[model samples]
Target: MAKPVQLTWLTGAQAIRLHDAGLRPPRGPFAYALVCDVRDPALAALANLALTDADLADERAPSASARTHFRARRSLLRALAAAALGVSPTSVRIAYDSDGAPRVDGLPAFVSVSSRGPLAALAVASSPLGIDLEPFDASAEPVDAVLHPREQAMLAELVSTARARAFLRIWTAKEAYLKALGRGFKRDPATIAATCEAAQFSIDDGGPAPLPVATFAPTMGLGDLIVACAVTA
Candidate 1:
């Protein structure tokens, strides 16, 4: 089981617009992340149009499919940030810091962006956070070298299909935490011990941290993708 995700599904236009919606921290137990399908021709067009000259250059620098993915996700990312901050979409500039984590200019909130194929995700919180979206593939490698001893034990208890789900779920959670740490995969996965049981995932990331983490299947109706979000405790 994973924490329930209270997702706000934005239309392609809302995702590309700058409105009165301004940046605010999520209240209560609910953590927020915006998800959109950029594969839609309409959304893709808006995303391309939303791109700044710099964004276009970055998009063009990637391979064909990746270029499109980058543009779509970044487009939505800008719109989401702008809406939250009540600013023009073009006024919201995204710059990568030394760690390569995306930051919205002049905002104090922590932001994370992820896209798999056409589905894109963005999370904004007052504390440092990370969010990841990964499609489940039984054939993909699980556990990898990042497996914590406790997580390995948890996996050993599952069999068949359940085993695969648990493996991917745990991986997503761990990756999310690493992102929250602001270093991404630049750190060893083993650096944070991970275990998933029931709907909650816990980790001993070697800290006396103060934020909680939530992992859940997204409500975007994207078939078999799983999402996990981590925020400061």
Candidate 2:
């Protein structure tokens, strides 16, 4: 069985402290994810100093909030990658591939970034990986549009809050798998099937075998947000 991905929730001060200390997550075939608030003032300041000219040129968000989030995510990504590579944060460059997936220049590491509300997440691994975040809505109804037929059938057995929570897990798993595949939503989400059991998840996209997915929720004192990370195993 594949090992589950580990997630770390950090504050702006905590992340900065770790970076300063040159601390990196455990190295191996496994993946790791980090989450933090993008709206924090300390993070914003760190982003302003860490971002390079190329990183700034990539910021074309139409609104101020979008721009701020973009900068924060990029800065966080650079910091994490730099720590792993044991280099200066500003020296690390991030570029997007043709599929719009972010890549760390000159490194074999794979990365994915996601945000929901005030929080942002980053996933890193030696292999291709993806991460997704979604705000859980207690009043949400299961939406069949993005679910496979099998998934719809499974969700139909649940009611009210149970159904809503199940839908959130399935949704994040499918989305994360798609991102990991570097296709994102270009491929129909309904074609991907996801099964959730407690903190574990499995995704079937008509592949040779079901892919393992790891999920974390109610993290960092935010009970309303759900996160999922997927990698080809």
Candidate 3:
């Protein structure tokens, strides 16, 4: 049997340095990598990597902002592929399924990444894995529409978005679950089940049974983004 591969998370600068300059520790065999980001410097680096210089220069700053965010996502993904395959950052190739989940062709491992406004996170593993980081934001739209009636009731008891930043916890957990499946919002948001107790929980999916992923919902960041990670065997 193959030994379990380790999971590592890094910021954009860290990932770039680690991959391009060999500044980080060696990742063991079959490890999967994930990088998450919010739309900021991280996005800039990712965009610069993906867009041609001429095209980028011609792009209107405000109008192109959406593309910039998408490009940044691609850049992080490209870097992950390169790092995972032990190749030059430029040599990493990515292919995606109909769902837009990323995969490195011909590699035995799986890598996943996600980004939000100012933060980003990545996860890699021998087994499939997903990760997410979200800052608590009071302005986030009501999540009640997506929450299970039971889960919504529990969320009210555990924390109140009306009073604080409780939504980050649920959002992060949901994001993590989506990432784990490599399907993101493609799957019904409500189908992936978790409790508001701020811990890992299983999804109702039948295959092998979804495992409890990890959640890092700090008590004080109610108004901040909550982060979560899920893995499957």
Candidate 4:
């Protein structure tokens, strides 16, 4: 039987410590989701962790802050994947697909990642999955560029604050779904329909059926971020 999905929340420092201690995820048909703060200073030490030449080539960024964030996120992902596969972090090789989605070499697990500001989210599952994170902006409103007509009409009915939250819920859901499909924005956001009601979230891409999408409940320390995950189900 497939294992129930496990969700892990970690700081960059905690991830580094866990990796050093050789901690691993539960085995057998595992699906894991991890969310971390990539801005943690402790992650800087991870720059010394073993990375493929390709990974090193891609590490070059225009700004120091961007480089730091990239290294932290990549290092955390390698740590998580290594733990999941019960291998050393250095043995885990990461490659990217044409869509720029990260893939663990020789591993069947499907992986997806997203980040906004200091936060990063990762999803690794037996089946295809996608995860997205976005900071909550109370003043942000739905835009015509990305919203479906139905979504716009739905948001129009809500008050300002509610509209902002609802827009993010929809936006993240759509992004996650597209990522799951491995198409990203190649599929127009304006063409996908997404909805979040109460504790439930759903997406309809005009396929034979709606996609399975979920919105993570607001955690104490992450109250200002909107997180969503989509998986084939």
| Candidate with maximal lDDT | 2
TM-score of 2: 0.87
Per-residue CA lDDT of candidate 1, range 1-233, in tens?
A: 12233434443345444233344434543334766677766455446645777667656434788877887778767766655555567787777779888777776555787777778778765556788888888765456588877777777877877878888888888788888778998998876776655787776766563234577675545677777888763
How would you encode candidate 3's per-residue C-alpha lDDT over 85-154 as one tens digit per residue?
6665465555666776666566655667655543446655557777777766666654776665655666
For model 4, the local distance difference test gives 0.73
**Per-residue CA lDDT of candidate 2, range 65-163, in tens?**
888788888887887766655667777789888988888898767788888645887877767788898888888888889989999999999999999
Model 2, runs deviating above 4 Å = 1-18, 25-27, 41-45
Total colliding residue pairs, candidate 1: 10
C-alpha lDDT of residue 67 in model 3? 59
Q: Tens digits of per-residue lDDT for model 4 on 1-233?
A: 11124445443355557767866766645556666676555655653465667777767567777776777677777766766667777877778789877787887677788976457887776666788988889998788799999899999999888989899889998998888888888989999898766787778777776765777744636557788888763
TM-score of 4: 0.83
Clashing pairs in 1: 1-198, 1-199, 2-199, 21-83, 22-84, 23-84, 23-85, 210-233, 211-232, 211-233
What TM-score against the true fold does each predicted structure earn?
0.81, 0.87, 0.67, 0.83
For all predictions, the C-alpha RMSD in Å is: 4.4, 2.7, 5.5, 3.4
Counted clashes in each candidate structure = 10, 0, 25, 0
